[model samples]
Structures are given as C-alpha cells and as structure tokens.
Target chain A: MTYRTGTEAFIQGVRTLIPLTPGVIPFGLVTGVMAIEMGMSPGMSMGMTVLFYSGSAQLVALQLLQNGAVPVAVVVTALIINLRFIMYSASLAPYLHHLPRRWTWPVSYMLSDQSYALCAVKFSSGELGRFAPHFYAGTAGAMWLTWQLSVLAGVYLGASIPQTWSLSFAVPLSFLALLVPNIRGAASLGAAVVGGLIAVFAVTLPYNLGLVTASVGGVIAGLLIESIRKKALSNASTNDVEREAQ
Target chain B: MSDLSLWGMFLAVGIGTFVMRLSFVEIYGRWRIPTLLSRALVYVPPSVLASLVLPAVVYPHGQGAFVFDNPQIPAAIVAAWIAWKTRSTVLTLALGMAVLWGVKVIAS
Candidate 1:
C-alpha cells in the first residue's frame, strides 16, 4: 500500500510488526529470566539487555558465562552469533545509504532479525517511496520498545521462581526454533548437521572454542554441498545436449 | 565473573556488533563485498544455531560428556519438530518446556 505521508507509512510499519510480536515476546522474556537466573543483578541484567539488544547473542553469552568460559571466548561467541547482522547491514545499505549519519547510525543499531525481515520485503517491493526509512523506524522503534518492556517484565518475574522448573532449557529450545526455519535446502541441512555433530564432539574444547570450530565447519560443509550440487546440474544439462545431438 | 569483567565483555561485544551492523552502510560505495563471502553468509545462521543447540541439548548440564538418556534430547526433538511445523517461537518454547517437565515428572 502507498502512503501519502511519512506518518502513514510509519504507522503501517508498526502495524506490520504487531503480528510478529507474539514470537518475539517469549524470547525476550526468556532472555531476561535467563540473565537474572544466571546471578546477574537486575541493574546489570538491564544493562546487558540495553547494550546488546539481541536476544540470541545475550542468551549465548549467558550460557558461555555459566559454563565458566573466559570473557574473550564469551565475546567472540556472542559476536559470531550476531554476524548475521553484517549480512542484513549489507542488504539494507543500498536503501539506507542516502540518509544522514544520525539516521543511519541509530537505524543500523536498531536492526534486528524481525525488523530486517519486515523492511527487506517492504523495500524490495518499492512501495514505501520516500518514507521507507520512516516506516523502518516505526517497526524498529516498536520492536525495541516491545523487547525492552518484555524483558523488563521478565526481570521482575524471574526471581521467586523455583529452580526445579528447568527454565534454562528454553535457551537451546529457542535456538532450535531459530535453526529449523533456516534449513531450507540440502546445503543448509548439511551445514546444520555438520555443525551440530562437530559441536557435540568438540564439547571438551576449552574456552568454548567448539562453537567456533563447529560454525566454521558447518559453513564450509554448506559451501561444499552447494558447489557439488551446481556441478551435478551442469553435468546433467551437458548430458542432455549430447543426447539431443545424437 | 566480577562486575567489571562482565561489563567489559558486554562493551566489547556491543562495539563489535555495532561495527558489523554499520559496516556496509558506512562503506557501501567505497568497498564491494566479496562474492564468496556473500554466498556463505546464508549458511551462518544455521551453522551457528545448530552448533549452539546440539551441544546445549545433548549435554544439558555442561558436564562435557554427552548423556544418551538426557531428557533434554527428547524435549528438544519434539521442540524442533514443532518449530519446523509451526514456525512459532511461542508454541515451540511452550511445547518444549511442557515436554521436558512432563518427561521429568514421568521419569521420577
């Protein structure tokens, strides 16, 4: 839908994000609860939350910290988890580069998986016109508010809960939820399998280096499978041409 | 584990992450990303996430040993299946937690 004014587009952006909030709220709450449960003071929990502004990275950092991982390892692993943001930044750069530094800086900082997904679709459709950035700000701003408030709620609610609930398992479960949707083809599936197996075998690695190793191995496996598939398709096409000539 | 250390780690990651998010936007015209790197970026999420999920589920207690009978294994499987089918984070988490609790209750 075309918007005559920036406000209309911004409102539309917020509306588009509402449906996705249900998926986000639980993760936010889990991140908050996990942080507090890891013995972080509420003040510190909010500090990390606001600083990182990333649920997956925050959770992974917490998990590594709980495992007695070194600070350097925790930082590396968390940064690795947030690497996908680089891809998002690249994808949205063309659309956002014309904006001022002030707009570009905060907009990039507010980039989340959900906001990227929403904005990518809108930008590609080329419907938002001059207000594309405004629409993005709408979605990103709403998402930011929703995330912080949900996490804040969880922080307050995290205490007084018994330890028997095994709430920590939700961390990995959330990762699994994120993982499944990414496995769309054979290459990605191979990547995940290799990555998972390597992690399990390398669990004994010090400083949580297994995660780094597995991630690299998985990406390499995916590249290998992708090239192999391409070669097979080319070979089959060549065979078809030879038969036609015969 | 001290407050100072924790904040340091947070600052490091925060700065690093922001730089990454701003990388292309800051230099879009000055630099072109390598074609191979762009292609491989698609696999990063799956690889990293699986790497994280598998270990967490297989070795629930972080004992550095995989336990075949870990309740988290089955719970994670069910959750993975639910995630694939529903693609709903809330549902996946709700069912996974419920399954873990149910399995624990039954086993005890």
Candidate 2:
C-alpha cells in the first residue's frame, strides 16, 4: 500500500513465499538424493544444482543422462521443460522492462515456477513500479537459498537414508503435489492423462525424444480441449437465450 | 553420459535455459508473444509434471512394465488423493512416504 524500497520489496516477496517453503524443501531434497543415487560426483551434482537451479529439469536431465542419452538431448529436454519461463518472463516483462541490464540479468536467471507464480500475481496487481524487480528478487533468492541448503542436506544424508526406505519415491510425490491442485477442468485432466500415457508409450524412442513428444502432445491436447469446452459453453448459453426469448 | 559428457549436458542446459529466461526479460515489451504460444504455455506445467510423475511412479527406472509390483504406484495413488483432498504438500509427503515404507516392510 505504501511506496517501498528495493530491500523492502525483496523482504515482502520472501514473506509471500513462506507458506510454500515446505513444498519446496522436499523437492530440493529429492533432487539432491537423486543426484547422489545416480552416482554423480558430489561436486558435479552440486554443480548441477548451481548451474541448472531447476528441480524438474534437473530431475529430467539426471534420469536421461543415466539412461545414456546424448548431451544434445539432455540439454534440449532441460530447455524444453523450462520453456514455461519464457511465458512467465513475457508476462513479467511489462513490469520490469525498464530495469537496468545489471538488475534484469540476475532476475531472469533466478526465474522458477514458484517465484513466477508468486510474482506474477503481485506484479499484475499494480502495486509495483521500479521496485517490482526487487520483490521478484526476494522471492527468487529465498527459493534459491532453501533449494541449495536442502540439496546439501540430502547429499550429506545420502548414505544413511537406507535403500529400503524407498525415499526416491518422494520425487514423484512432490510432482504429484504440484500437479493435483492444477487439475481444475477436463482440459487439464486430458493433458495429464494423454501426456503421461504418451510418455510411457513412446519410451523406446532414442535420446529421450519421447519426453519431448509427450510435453508437446499434452499441451496441444489441453489447449484443444479447453477451446472445445469454451465453444460448447458459449453454444449452450446461446441455446438458453433462444429458449428464454421464446 | 560419460563424466565429460555430463559436464557438457550441464553447461549446455545451463546456458540454454538462461538464454530462454533472458529472451523475454531482455526483450520485454518490444517483441510480442504470439497468441498460440501464450495459450500453450498455460498447459506446460501440468503436461511436464504429469509426464515426469507417471514415469517416476509407474515405470521407475529398473522396473519392466507398470504393474502392482512397484510400491510407488499405490503410494503415489494415495498421495495423489491426499494432494487432491487436502491440497497440502507436507501431508502428501509425510503420508506418502509413510505408506511407501509400510508397503516395503509388509511386502518383504
């Protein structure tokens, strides 16, 4: 409600993401556990965290890399998985386009699913001006810190976790937590079912191309179904109007 | 997939993803995103997460085909339901992990 400094905006941003902290912690731990379990060198695995900073893409790359996929495929999958950020950035661009290059670079680097979600709503609320970038930086920084620390803890605890525990299942469980709430309608449900089925069916494709195929197929299905539903709803309303007129 | 190649994947993906993020931040309002692309982006999270989720829970890595053989499948089903109902990530994790461990003990 009041004009805020960059530091204040940053603090405010971190505050907004506090409730989501528990959700983020497990995913980071799962990523760290997977990196160690995959037999990656500790430094290399940590390097992946620092370099990629994305749990989904990191997990995807880890699985494919262990599967002996090519470098190009692995990189492409990571990039493809992160394509949503481009859209997020586009939406955020209007609020932050005026920022200096020095500020914009770091802000872009820290973009993630959680930060984008939190900031997108905030930015669109018209509360931000030049200080908006600071708020985003705050959310991203909090997430970055939590993720790295959790990964480190997981890496340190990698040996003692015990194999029988089936801890790796947490990765998918985390993803399920992320996905379940988003299934608001048939389009999303169609997207999930079709995309998941296609991923399995096309598993034999070389270089992890099946994953890419599934991503594209699922998005297309969701979008198509969404449009169809919209059309159906409009048509139904039109019919209702005609009946009322008679 | 070699050690050296792992580094390559890291560097390549790191740079590629960074550039993707920068594409919009740097361009900002100058370049417009197409309507189709905007619409498609909304579905990306569900699609990407679903693709990842199904494989991890069902096929896993070593398992052959997805049957009731893997403990993760049932645990994930319960987790999915918990997530749907409570919509709490912590509960889903705690309960899901508990279910998974319980199954492991009993199945053995």
Candidate 3:
C-alpha cells in the first residue's frame, strides 16, 4: 500500500499496465490498417493518430470518411465519441486538482479510459498518498507509447495483413475484457444491460447517434435502480425500528 | 475529402477533445462537482463500454441489420466468460480470436 518513493510507484504503475497492452495492441493495429485502407497516406494516418490519441474515435471518423460522409459530420461524431473524456476528467479532478499546471495539463491530455480505470480506484482508496500523480503519469506514458508504436507498425504493415485474420473483432473482445471487470454490483450490471440493449436496438440511428443515446439511457437506468435499492433498505430499517418500539 | 479538409477536420476534433479532457481539471477548485452528476459519472464507463461492445458484436459490420448466425456473438460470449474467470486481457483476446477463426472455418 505504501511506496519508498515516487519512482517506485511510477514503475508499479507501468508494470500494472503491461497486462492490458495485449488488449490495446490489436485495436491500435486495426485502426492504423483501417486508416491506410481508407486511402490515407502514412503521414496523414500518423497525424490523425497522434492528434486524436483515441482509437475508437479515430476509427469511427475514418469509417465515416470512407463512406463519403461530410466533413462536418465526421468532426461532430468524433467529438461525440470523445465526450466520455469529460466524465473522466471530472472524476479525476478531485485527485489531481492540486498539481501545478505543468503537471496537470499534459496529464489531462494523456488521460484515456485505460489509465483512468487503473487510477480511479487507486485514487479513491487514498492508497497512493502523495505519489498518486506519478503513478498516473507512469500508466499514461506507457499507454501512449504502446498505442503510437503499435499503430505505426500497423501502418507500415498495412495491406499485407490478410482480411481473413479478422483483427477488427479484437476491438470488441478487448472491450468485453474491460467491461466484465467494471460490473462489480447490481447497479453497474443494470447500467451495462440497459446500455447494451439500447445500443443493439438503436443501431439504425443516423450519425452514430445511437451510441450517445444508449450511454445516456444506461446511466439513467443505473441511477434509478440505485435510488430504488436505497429506498428499500431505508424502509426495511424503519420497519425494524417500529417493531422494536412495539 | 481533400487532404487540407481532412487535416482541418482532425484539428477540430483534436482541439475539441483536448478541451473536454481539460474541462474539469482546469476548473476543479473553482467549482465543485454536483453530487448527482458525480454519482452519474460512476456509471459512465460501464454504460459507455457496453454500448460500444454490444453494437460492435451484434452488428459485426456496423450495419443496422442483426443476424442470429453471426460468429461474433458466440465468440464474444465465450470471451466474456474467459475474461470473467481469468481476468487476463492477454488470455481473453487470444482465446476470443481463436474462437472466431474456428467458428468461421466450421461455418464455411
């Protein structure tokens, strides 16, 4: 629970992130391949990769562009997909707010779902103490390096990778791995079920709006279930007290 | 889209995303997060991830149509089970890809 120094905590963070890199590598490779297949030059593809630093959003934008969608639509949809970062930013703010701008700015820019997931619980538990930011930086730095290098490899190896490999499926598979761990309680379970079903039923929506809708629906479902469970618990306690009075 | 236009779009998205990422961190002490919004934030990862995973699996091509015989559904189910049991990302991905390739071969 304690570390000798920030360097030790940072190394620990990097070590923990190593296991998740397997899930990340294929997704990054697929993104790189898809961008090239869509006729983007290697320089342009890397430019998008470095700029976006988001695999899913970048992939979605590339798909939209390949379909000849308007430039405005591509930009909007990508931004919408990146909306979850705002939630991550808010969640992490309390833990990281005290750091100076030099530390906070780059750390914010490097935030990703993987790093946030790793750090959120650690930060909340107050286990890392003063070295928490260093640990976070370690995870984010490793993830950034892993992603950029894998995508670069994919770009160079593009077209030669056979379609029969079905690498795109790896994207969902990795998400499943991440999703299973996040379902820690009934509330989170409700959120996942509602979100997934809505997405399944709303796949026909334009501009990939179904994703946004499904996410909102799922969060609301979770909140509703959580409040209901809380009320039931309170009522049961009150009834117990009344019986004791009798 | 032309090269210039494509770059412009990327820049727009990149800047927008950066702002969102910095939104709360930049103003953290200035404004407190409301209790309700903070509570809702806990569900964001599960809901958003499930939203992405389900659609991608059910509609393998990102097309709206759903098919009962899709290999991805079963592959995903198996992978989910493995992930739950093992909690190993490497193992889950490796087995999931293996299952998908096996199913495709058998179906053909």
Candidate 4:
C-alpha cells in the first residue's frame, strides 16, 4: 500500500475501535480501583494503564502485590497470564511483517484482546488492505488512549466509591462473559476441564505458577485430542480408498 | 506503602510486560516455532482466563480455602449462567454485583 492509502487504513482502524471503548472503560475502571486498594498510587496505576495496557494482568498483579508477593513473583504471574498475546502477535504478523520497525513496535505494544478481535474481523472480512497495519494502529491507539483515561477516572473515584456495591464480582463476571461461549468444541472443553482442575489443585504454587502449569496442561490436552482426531480421519480415508481399489 | 517504592514497582511491571510482549516479535522473526507449539498457543487464553477468574470466584481472599459460607459463589454462578446465555459482559457483571451486594446485605 502506498503512503497515502496506508493513512486511510489507519483512520479506518481507529474508527473500528470506537465501539469497543465502552467495554474497555469499565474494566479499566475496575483495575484502577484494585490498584488503589492494593496501596498503589494513582500515578503508578496510570503508568500501568499506559505501559502494561492489559486489564486482566494488571488486576492480577495488583492482587498479588496485596498478598505481599515479591516483585519477581508479580511480574512472572502477569507474564503467564498474558502469554496468549504472543499468539495474537504471531497471528497478526503476516499482515504487519512488512511494516517499518517503528510502526511494528508501537502497533504491537497497543495490541490487546479487543483490538486484536476487531483486527481479525476486519482482516477476515476482506475490508483490510495491504495497509491493514495502519488500520490496526488506529484501532490499538484508540483503545490505548481510552483505556488509560478510564483507569485514571477509576483511580480518582475508586477510594470514594461506596462499599455497599460489590465491584469485585465484576472481574470474574467479565471472564465468564468471555469464556462460556468459547467452550464450544471438545478440544476447548478438554482444555478448560483439565486447566480448571490443575488450577484448583495447584493454587498453593508461589507466584501463581499453577496458572502457567494449568495452561500448559490444558493446551497439551487440547492439541493431543485434535491430533488424534485428525489422524483418525486420515486413517478412515485411507481405508476407504483401499476398499474402493478392491 | 512507600510512594517511591510503588512507582518503582510500577516501572518494573511496565518494563517487564513490554519486554515479554516484545519477545514474541523479536524472537519469532528469526526462529520458527513448531506446529504443536502454535496449536498449544490457542488454548492459553482460556486456561489463563480460567486461572484468573477461578481464584476470585472461589476465594475473595488470597488464601487457598474455599468460601462456601459466602454468597459470592451463588452470585457468581448465576452470573456465569447469565454470561453464558446472553454473552453480554455488562449485564453479566451488573447481575453478579447486584446479587453479591444483595446477599452480603442479607447475610450481614
């Protein structure tokens, strides 16, 4: 894509992110409050908003810190929690690999769950062109800005919010909202079941290593099932071909 | 409790997170990962999300013990069903919070 065309793609990407803002806003608000409750300053919270830019990881880190976990522990926990971003980055690489290094760095930095979702939708729909990275940059940039602002709002308001309302449930509820529909296939079911059991059993692991282990275990189970399924299908096809020859 | 220390922690987290994210791009460009590794990546999100959510659902405190005495369990279960049925983040959260608060008030 030409420079002029890429510029348009960037604008298109920013537009797609607008609808996602409302969903991100409340999550960020919760993260900011959680940080404050954990004894972190507003500046520190906002810095996390800008830098980490991940609501789930930020919330998990805050809780870990509150538990008096060491810095290494907190960081490792967040990394394990966010390991999926590597997959997201890899998925988008084909679309964005040719972009300038400066372009790739910031765009990758801004990538998150919602932005990646939007990008995937656009890319699959054929709406995205060679300048798709520009579009992604726009979507991610908007999300990043809105996410930071929402956290800042929460930091200012979290301390004053009444305790009568239970906001803590919002976190798990959000995940439930995201997770339930995804448990569609046998692969997903196997993964979730194995992962859940492992997490419950390994909760005592320091720095939430149970999370990493459970995730690895779940992924392994899912992949194994899928591979077996593929192999079975291939074998059946070969047997059919032999019968036809007879 | 120290302000400077908190900022230091924030910086550490922020920098650490960035470096971790950057690793996927920097390393993967030169080295190709196996197909099994790629397939495993797909399950990471669900497992990680479950790990994050289960702890909060089962134990509000950092402890390993379950809080069956608390109402958060029923509230969360109801909310989980709502989430599954409607697939709406806002509604699920709102319902869960309302139930949790209502239970807390009645119990207390």
TM per prediction: 0.95, 0.91, 0.82, 0.86
**Candidate numbers, best TM-score first, in rank order:** 1, 2, 4, 3
Segments of candidate 2 deviating more than 4 angstroms: A235-246, B61-64
Cα deviation at B76, candidate 4, in Å, is 1.4
| Alpha carbon lDDT at A225, candidate 2 | 85
Across residues A148-180, which tens digit of lDDT does each residue of candidate 4 receive? 888888899889876556666666777776677
* Cα lDDT of model 2 by residue, A28-64, tens digit: 7788888898888779889999899888889878777
Candidate 1: global Cα-lDDT? Answer: 0.89
Model 1: DockQ score: 0.64
lDDT of 1 by residue, A34-109 (tens): 8899999999999998889899899999988889999999999999889889889988898899999999999888
For all candidates, state DockQ relative to the true structure: 0.64, 0.58, 0.57, 0.47
Cα lDDT computed for each candidate against the true fold: 0.89, 0.81, 0.83, 0.73
After the best TM-score superposition of candidate 1, give how far the Cα of residue A94 lies from its true spot, in angstroms. 1.1
Q: How well is each residue in B7-99 modelled by candidate 1, as lDDT tens digits?
A: 999989888999998999989998887778877887898999999999889887794776676789889989999999999999999999999
lDDT of 3 by residue, B1-108 (tens): 689999999999999999988889999878876777767776776787798789888887666778887999889999999999998877888899999999999999
Worst 10 residues of 2 chain A by lDDT: A237-246
Q: Residue A83 of candidate 3: its Cα lDDT? A: 76
Worst 10 residues of 2 chain B by lDDT: B60-69
Worst 10-residue lDDT window for candidate 4 chain A reads A237-246
Q: Better model by TM-score, 3 or 4?
A: 4
Worst 10 residues of 3 chain B by lDDT: B36-45
Question: Candidates sorted by lDDT, descending order?
Answer: 1, 3, 2, 4
TM-score of chain B of each: 0.95, 0.84, 0.82, 0.74
Clashing pairs in 1: none
